[model samples]
Target: MIALTLRQRNIIEYLLSRDSYVTNDVIASNFEVSNRTVRKDLEVISAYLKEQGISLVRKPGKGVWIEDKQEVLFDDLSCSYSKNERIVIYVTSLLLNDVNTFMTLASNCGVSKQTVINDLNTIEKFLDGYHLSLIKNQGVGTSLEGDETDIRRLFIDLLFTNDHSKIVYELCINNDGIQRNLDVSFELITVIENEFRFRYVDRDRISIVLSFLLNRLGLMKTKNSTIQSSDMERINSILSTKISDSNDQEYISSFLLGERVEGSLTLDSKVEDEANEISEHLISSLKKIHYFDSEDMKDIIRSLTVHVRAAIYRCRNNIHIRNELDEQVRFAIGVMYEFTKKELNVYETKYNLNFDQSEISYIALYLASIFETGVQEDLKVVIMIVCTFGLATSSILKSRMYQIFGDCFIVGPYSIEEAEKYLESHEVDLIISTNYMSVKSTNVIYINPLLKQNDIEMIRNTLFQESFMKMCSLFFNKNKVVEHDYHCLGEYISKNDVSISKGKISWEDAIRKAAAPLVAKGDIENKYVNTMIQAVNEFGTYMVITPKVAYVHAGKDDGVNKNCVSLLLLENEIPFGSFNTKPVIAIVVLGICDKEESQLLNIANILDIPENIELLKNSKNIESILSLHD
Candidate 1:
């Protein structure tokens, strides 16, 4: 026997696998080695093959191939498995099969016998993670040396971690004995689903898994191993009735915990509590990317809570499943996905666990659906959305409603009849109905059943007016009213309540100077100016309403005596921060007496228009500026 190097054996096996001649480039790519290295390896391989009565045939301008006068030298290493796939095969074999010798495993995987030896080294490292070790005997075979339970757990863990897309091709591709076993396994799954009154999300994947397990039922290894699960006893009994082997039963029962049958998971108090806390955290984290607070959002909160509970159960049990939407979520909302991943580290650490990206990806997906709606607003408008369409369509409309509206509290995607009955008992601020309301209220808006783009446009405009009127109604009450030096945005300025600066000033100074007019007139105390400065320090240029203008204010108790507005018009727009891309041409300081909540909305409305903002920037005097708004 020639002492062949591992690469020589691999090159020989590679050539043996190919039916026709292969170029050095092809071999190089397969082995991830250079063509020069491959040529050298082939020289070594050729010597070894000659000793074995095999010839390494090289045809110029064609490629190199093995010429064997005899029959098949190797069982075709063409169907080579990737490292990950090989790892899965090793894990599966280690659990049930005893024929785990280097040569035997290599022959099965279509690689050099030495490749299996190298793979075993890697496999041993993986086993260490599960607190299991490989007991290998030289020139013989390897066996899993650990608790039966740990062995089973290692199997389950590896199965979920890898998709193993090709793991069951032989078993599933119409072989007689294996196909019969597959039929039994599939029937077992149906029985399990029926027994639990729930179905597997991916039934085909489960069938593949069960089929793999059934085919590997090696002539009764022993009844030594038991899978640790809350339903282990029940699973054993269930599998026992169908499967005869007590030890092999765990193979079927272990994956029983992987049953994620949507909304079917029952949460105990402790899990429920953790779920609640984590759900709130998830929402708070996502709110950074978008404004939230609605009935649909509440449903999201509940759905999120339930999902986290299931995910926690799955993680604690070391059961990870493939979420199909995982990649889609990570790509669609990459920012939210990354942010959620970072935010979830707190929960992971607090709980003393690591979460699979599949689990985190699911959370990201739920949040992405909400974030995708792109409805940015702070004021919450209560709306009763009545849809005559079916439940599925209404459910869709509700999602669409969230996508389009800001901070709205949706009452119901009720039928017209449901809305009428509800309206009698409960007072909603606005009624948005697909079917016209027979009750006929001033707040109601009718629309098409489809809820088209034009309907959204009309609905948004109506909602804006409704929100403004509702805000304006706040200051109409007498007790809510405060005696003020200036009654409105124009009046404060009409009576010596503004600043005009040439060139530029510090934003802090701009805010202070802007509020000076109101401060001097006693509409607000000097303390209000300091609060505005501190707020800007804390919240940045959030007050900068429309890129060109800023609205600065503190709480009314921050020494606001009167509801008033003041503006600092800077000739050269000054950037608020070192990195502030939007410069402030004007800073509108609002000093509100609690009743002037509508002022923010009003100023936003005026400055929101580019023409009005441009006019305000050019206004030289109080009268000219006041006239700009008018």
Candidate 2:
């Protein structure tokens, strides 16, 4: 007698289960084994069948099939085996002779007896292996020790490895008589089955799968087929009844209308019709909502529609729902409704929102914070004009400083004692003192506050310019002014107006007489043009007023012109005008009169102020002088 290996027996069983033929590739792919292994098994099965006088035929790509069967030698092995050997042999024998039971045996061999019993309990796989009777005799325990080969073969013939294929075949037979039945495509059926399979194990996966298949088919056919609105209403009425019968009103409400129903109703034909009508309406509504431009909203609608539809289908199919499932559905619906409301509100306010003052203030504060954090880096300085008393002179001096510095410096007035007390702790760069008050320990640079414009300009230019010769000259010049109260001749022209001499006078004498009062006040001194040149060289430019330039302007002009003298001197000129004719006067006031300083030379040139003559010489009275100044 020839013995068949377990794999060879599997190949034979595999071929026996097929009505037509079995392919080697199919066997290999199914078993996840090499093709050579499958072929070797097939060769062994073919040789074993041949020895038994059974013919096995191969038809190349078509596959191998059993051609003929003959009576085999070991058809009755009972005579050669005892009962105990038979039981052990029967189990092992069943394992070697069949594919399904072989799988069970291989699975249970290494596990505990409890596991084997569990395997035995699965009726389908347990009875699949051999031609034997399963007898359970209470105290005797379960046994599969009786002979029944033909019955087993018949049973095996009815089964297939792929369960889905078996289901499709059964469905085709059951629904054959129904007219206009749904045409099920393989891919569509598989997709619907897989989509809800794991998610809904307790419910009928096959029924839900079929419903989706029918729905897909209907939707495809209805794509271009238009039904009138009235017909749609009738169709919806029919569907709503079906929908109602399938699910409770409250459960159905969360899905179709995004609201809850208050009461329950009987699941009669009328309720079925109402349910169907509602479902139809829901499907239409979902279709319309699915095409919404926003993807998020579309997903929301689709999810709710699917939930409601599934509930109705399950209800119609007599499926039960757990409390947990119902609660989850309710929670999902509530969340979606809230989200939809928020989205709608957002859309409503998009075109109407307005920014207010608080918003602007917040923005300004944010920008200020950024600046304070090193976004902008520049120092802003302020100068305080302090007199013993805060009176007109203090105000006048502050105004003068502001006129020169303008936005470049912050200026204010305070009393001397107030300034001294404040300066004790406050920061200041420079202090101009009009009185004899002392600052014994402060670091501030001090100067005479009663000084002329030339002295102020000299101090300013010296502080700014770094040239050695200019610094030495500035020091010597400052000392001379401090020691002798020496002021530039340009100050004489600035103070005195153009006057007609009462007696005959030479040009030099007339100049001296015009300049006499300022000289008496210790304001006018020699080398005035040199002082103005130093101011111009240090500060880039300076103003000038000659006896001639001033006199001529004083005589010819009134109002603002009387107080304003001629301004002269180019950027490169050095001592360009005489003391008696020093056209250039005070340095272009630093930081102050920026705009006026920018146009001062241009305006002076336009007014015909000259460099070599007293332009204000013809002024007759102080009124004319004040008028010219104004």
Candidate 3:
């Protein structure tokens, strides 16, 4: 089936949502896109609808509307959407298949050959980042040229891209190499859960099941195939006649045990000696940073030992488990996440690997449990679940919700009438329903009853906003809120502007140049610059906050004239010692004469956004940079 782009799907939904036909110009303005872009999106949408035996009528003045409204068709398009995701999945499928010609791939993906070629170029770049390559021979067609483990890693990554569970289940049931008669993937998942005696998270289960199916498809293999006597016995009890091959049993058992043998997979070792060794290092590193307490030493060690063991295995094999909570974790945890990431770098470098956001998030998840109560305690937003399909489904969803959200919500499953009555008497922060209900509430969010990852993300984002608002209300005066320290980037730049460094410079020289702006602005004396340089020379470039951005600041005691901030965009990337791979593209200097007037935290928060950092780097003038604040 042809997948629609997010914009195309959104356009269709917009048209469907409205009774009257809206003009193209209106939509273009609404979406902040050119009229040409809107027209093109509509054309794609209209063509897609036409293929489904529906007509999208367009009147020049009145705009566009569907002739026969088909919510089911639109819903299907929405479900199977996302252009980048489709391209990634299509390229992955082509890489695994026998035929790899652009024509054949395009035909399979239901796109033009040119589009397939373009996607291949994008795929090539993506593979390069993973230290893999896409090679196209004169007659042998195209292939993914990479280490066997990396190839398998790519497969798992692609499989878990969009609507992972739904897509994986279909792949397992329909793939020619896998058994079509039985739901082998689902059954294997159940067997693993039973043998392991621990429930895998929804996404993790999908990844595991898909990995098995991919193995059955002869595209991948499990690393370790060593099955213990006890594990083998348990597997036999669970599978019995379900799995016939002894090798298959061993392979599945090894995967469950998390032993690294070959294919990209997480290895779990229960060896107490190794566990103690890893736990000792983990605890020691965390203690040096004072990230956690020694009170729960045994439990922390045990938990982290297992986790780190699996993580080391994953790193060695290049298997990265996607963390759905990565963005939320980073946004909420902020400096804590950064600190955790930095501390974990010791292990990462030892393993000769770079930890993805997902892996860092796992670490944050560990620490957040320790120090999160202060922020997380009062953030529970009451959630009412409305699902007509019995209590079993609701109970399952409730359990999953709690698993993902922790104590962030007070969720209750309610019938439609029960929900209405409850809402009438009590306050509900949000309503999560399978089907659209005519509820007079602005906080109603429609989600799949199955609780898909995308649905979870949508719900998470909503709750995040709600929690942020609640936090703000609690801290700030509701009516007379404190204003932002600075109006915009332009204002900051104009007030405390610095010259961009010319030519390549040392990290020390760069800081000196960066501080010149503060000195010129009279924000700080020349002594402050010397203090910052000396501090960096002594302690190193810990001021390098995010990628391409660094904040250079010394304590008010060091040397300070007033509380102000200045920006310095470097013409060339400057390496700051052996700190990190990230080059210092923009240097934000802080002058803190007094701690009370310092907006260092707010400045860091603003620059934390990657796009804004890009703006700061690329801006020819302050006016251009300020445009981003809009």
Candidate 4:
């Protein structure tokens, strides 16, 4: 019997049902997949049908179809087991059969012995991640041997990756098993969450960790769990199944600490140093390539630093997130991603992180986030006015200089020697002097010692164009001043996000509804909303930023797949916190990813004014919200 993937089987069934040919576009559209994927599926289906003496016919412009196929039906043809499923069979069989060989394993999986060998070769690579090796005993068939901690983490991760694999693994534990305390794991997690005041990202993974821990407890003697005594007391209370003797307790604690984003475990202080060094290097390297020297780079660096810390922690623990932007980021910004990956090579060995493809995707995206927000402002001219004149004359000259050179810097009346010393150290754009200073610089403007109008005109004529380029050197450093929409912070809010209340709803519900549009649009992940509520729970109603409006958000790390903002208007008031007298009638949920919180102050501007709040309530239009910007 030929094995087919789920998609391959689906394609065969679709073709068999259709009397006429289905075009690639039609198949792609119907399946909600790309045309390229449809083509690949057809190729697989064609090979399978060829073995069974049937043809899958296709024309480039026309379509694809299976002609006169009566022997094959969906029910008769079984979907092939996935690789993870095959792994479950292999590992579970090894655990069950005392003297199982490749031929025996092949018989169990219903695949060729040669196929089993190939699968083992691939599975070996995966076990390498856990530092576990597939060892073939001289007499016994095969077994996994490595550190007990790695073994526990490996089983937990396998269960997390595929639920189907769990049933097979459970068979090894059913007899003389800890099935009586299966629910104890659930209770433990709940206790830990409430006791610790943090939510684990993958509850399912944690449950599997606890279950595996129970199955392996007392099977062998191991080292201490390495978990703190204080934290382990809570675990011991939940699972008094002699868990004290087991090291699985610490792995569970470690898993809990690693999975949660907000209450992340305190890593070595060097982690922060490494993240900062990497961020600075990326910034420096990017500047060299003309990627950006823009003002947004500062925000980019800060957010990237935060992400790098989390990525390093995840990498060290062998936790991996499948970055959605992995393919697109690599495709669009391959050069930048390559540069970032190269810069990170220095830390890989020290941290034991290869900078996996997904982590690199996010890092590259942050580097790409460095962009020009607006036109670069003119350069500021830092002027050092050299004055050999008296104090009263210097004060007059300073005041006069300020009045005349409105946009340029005015540094004093240094003695000729003082001016020369200052010129060597500081980056002065222009130098104004009343006396002939023995300066070798070209920007020195010699002026009359006495107060004269021509001196002012000469200053203007000599550096008028340069003075126009001057901005406040203290605050705006020429290219540092990013052009902002000073009048309105309305760029992010639009009609797609604005929603009127169907009726009055709970503040929590209102936030979910406000953010639901973004969730549905994939602008944010489903976890983003839960994190928002968690934020409000952890902190108070500081989310309620204004009188009748509330702006709520969690850090971008909590599950913001993209950056977005949404607004919900309520006809009735809902109290966000202790502000009963001033109940919030509007809610705004901000979803951000690997970026700065750039939208809050602007959204708050809308809520700050009474008229704008009224506009949001009365019109309930996106344009109304957009117009409320300062």
Worst 10 residues of 1 by lDDT: 474-483
Model 2's number of clashes is 59
Sort by lDDT, top down from the best: 1, 4, 3, 2
Clashing pairs in 3: 223-261, 223-262, 224-261, 258-267, 258-268
What C-alpha lDDT does candidate 2 achieve relative to the native structure?
0.35
Q: Is candidate 3 or candidate 4 better by lDDT?
A: 4
* Candidate-wise lDDT, in order: 0.63, 0.35, 0.59, 0.62
Could you say which candidate leads in lDDT? 1
**Candidate with more favorable, higher TM-score: 1 or 3:** 3
**How many clashes in each candidate?**
1, 59, 5, 2
Worst 10 residues of 3 by lDDT: 259-268
Q: Pick the candidate with the highest TM-score.
A: 3
The positional error of residue 143 in candidate 4, measured at the CA in angstroms, is 4.0
Model 4 worst lDDT window (10 residues): 471-480
TM-score of each: 0.40, 0.17, 0.46, 0.41
Q: RMSD for each model, in Å, please?
A: 21.7, 45.1, 16.5, 28.3
The per-residue C-alpha lDDT of model 2 at residue 550 equals: 24
User: What's model 4's overall lDDT?
Assistant: 0.62
Q: What is the C-alpha lDDT profile of model 4 across 146-242, one tens digit per residue?
A: 7766676556545444345445645434523335555777777777777666566657545655666666666445543433444455655655544
Segments of candidate 2 deviating more than 4 angstroms: 1-23, 26-37, 55-630
lDDT of 1 by residue, 1-630 (tens): 444544555677667677887876567646644455777778877776676677788886467877763543554322346687777677666665554677766765667878887887788887887888888888778777876557655554554544563463432344354455667777877777776666777676566567656665554465542336455566677777667776777655656554455444444446346767787787775555344664667666666676786677667656666665554344333334555676677878887656677888888777755654434342357898899889988888888888878478887899878887898888776778877677643367776666764467557655654553333232122112332222335733454666688865788788778887787788899888887766554333335445467767775468988777777788887776322123668887777673313255445444555677677767777676776542
